[model samples]
Target: MKAGYVIRDQERPHFITITVVDWIDIFTRKNYREIISNCFRFCIKNKGMILYGYVIMSNHIHLIVQSRDGKLSDLIRDFKKFTANQILAALHNEPESRREWILERFAKATETHTRNKNFQVWQYGNHAEEIFSLKFMWNKLNYIHLNPVRSGIVEKAIHYIDSSARNYADEKGVLDITLAENPVTDTRKNSEFWKYNSYED
Candidate 1:
């Protein structure tokens, strides 16, 4: 992992990106995307994950998350391990046209690493950036929401059903997320900061 991408403050919310090995577009399948959503639901319910924002793309996922129990790293590790196994199983048992090709890619990805035995689904290291301030938090939130829009998957961010953009728009999303609240006070300095840095999607 790179020095800057390391998670320093486990209790603070961080913007994280987890990518597929070789950037393969495995999540273009609905079943695979549902697996990701189910994992988030499990983590939030049982593992003390406080999910603020999330978006699942074709090959990667973006999230703004913190740990209620101060074990964010552990939570992430378990998530990846379980999700990888489930995805591999799905590729084998489910009806997939490119199952062999995708499995071959995953198998090839593990050739460089001893930790992975049969396959490697996710790439190593989450590019994590700690949310240092309210401005930074909202900036990451907008970035997460706008990812599908930038990819041309949807005209508006909220139209993407796999993202927390729907929750932010006051609609029920596939998974529950804790709505991030503005902590900024009405001081002159903070007012100026918000005026200059307020993010809009």
Candidate 2:
């Protein structure tokens, strides 16, 4: 487990990256992707987790998140644990073509790591950086939203259904995220940062 990047303030928003074990492309399937989306909604509604921005990539996910109940660490821990089990079940019970291969891979990953149980679906540590200022927040937000665009998955960031770019673009997205309050930079309709604020692309 990585000991670095501790959360000093549980209520403060942080940019987080959760990656799959061995960087596996587990989310290549639509079902697996939907599983993650459902988990996000569940966490938001019941775990006191605040979803600010997010993007689900093929093998990992980026999130701008905070907690209202002062249980950010616990929430994330449970989220990973639950998703791993749920996804493993899906691999076994669903019509996955690479079911056997994927299971073997997960099992192998567990054998080498003492922290894991039967299988290790997600990596142990998350790359977390606290969002302290408006500029930093915007920069990370743009990076998350533009991941798919940079990877050639979409021409526009808003077109990616698995990201918060749709929400920022003023469209009803998969998960509803709270816009940051009192952005240091003016996010008004006529402001210079309006294009990036509301995600023009």
Candidate 3:
């Protein structure tokens, strides 16, 4: 497991990339995709975090986000917890027989997580890498947008229905959203230098 996300160069906001437990492909189905999308939509609507660019790989998700109105860790924890429960319930009650096989996979990956009653839908580490410079964010954004292309699944970034690539490319997503400003620059990203106000240590 990755070490807990540290405030690397805490002078700016961070870009976090988290993977599924044991690289389980929980999102092979559309119902799973909807669950993840709902979590993103909820975070944006509630003004808890700024949803930037993202790409959904088979087993992981990448996000460029910054905390607002509260701690970033809490926001992510809530998101993971909610999605895990909802997705798990869907596996149980949603009459999708294919889900039985998926549940078996999830169970296998979560064996270690189930110890001490932990619901191990997702891996524990929320891999956060702070993004302080524009150049770095630029690269990360392009990396995110081009993930599908890199995988040879599609020739274009917007072709993937599971990503924010369409929104960033100025097309509306099925879920609907205004484009997240490209190059992902903002006061939030630069607020780290003065985070002393919110710092306790």
Candidate 4:
């Protein structure tokens, strides 16, 4: 599908969530999980977006970020595209020498899908929802941090390893995460007025 229907503004605060098609848990393997973490770094180092908080669910991901230098939509698109190809390649040539079993699991899942060659690591399209207010931003942040808790992965937010909950709570993580109140929209209450509106044609 074209981005026309799902397109969103990049340089704006947004509450974004993306899911794998059919809820496939492609990131259950640690190696694949690392790939996702790298995506976060790629965005930040490039000065595209600031990731406020996030959680990597079995098959889906929930995130809160804002585009500061570039479009958040383009950042997400690039991340997904780069990761999709990378994951697929790893599953093919390298096959995760460290996690061969996990590779096999992926191989088996793609057994029935026509789109996958050896496996389909990630499904495209992020389910993005722009956070338009302080209350809404806080709510979305809490929701993302609680994703693991809601899924029974951890009782406390800080314990979830593959999430940004720790960073928000002042705990150290593998990546440098800047946690602060993100400026919502350029126009306050009019925030919703421009959310998801692509400034770019």
Alpha carbon lDDT of each predicted model: 0.87, 0.83, 0.69, 0.69
What does the lDDT come to for candidate 2? 0.83
lDDT of 3 by residue, 34-107 (tens): 88888888887884667667777888888777777647767777788888889889888877766666667667
Candidate number that wins on lDDT, 1 or 3: 1
What's the TM-score of every candidate structure?
0.90, 0.89, 0.77, 0.73
Off by over 4 Å in 2: 1-4, 181-201
**Residues 54-82 of candidate 4: C-alpha lDDT, one tens digit per residue:** 88888888877777865777777777768
lDDT, candidate 1, 26-77, per-residue tens: 9999999999999999999989999999999999999999999988888788
- Descending-TM-score candidate ranking: 1, 2, 3, 4
Give the alpha carbon lDDT tens digit for every residue of 89-166 in model 2. Answer: 999899988888888889999887688778889987778888989778877887898888889988777778999887
Residue 23, candidate 1: alpha-carbon lDDT: 96
| lDDT for model 4 | 0.69
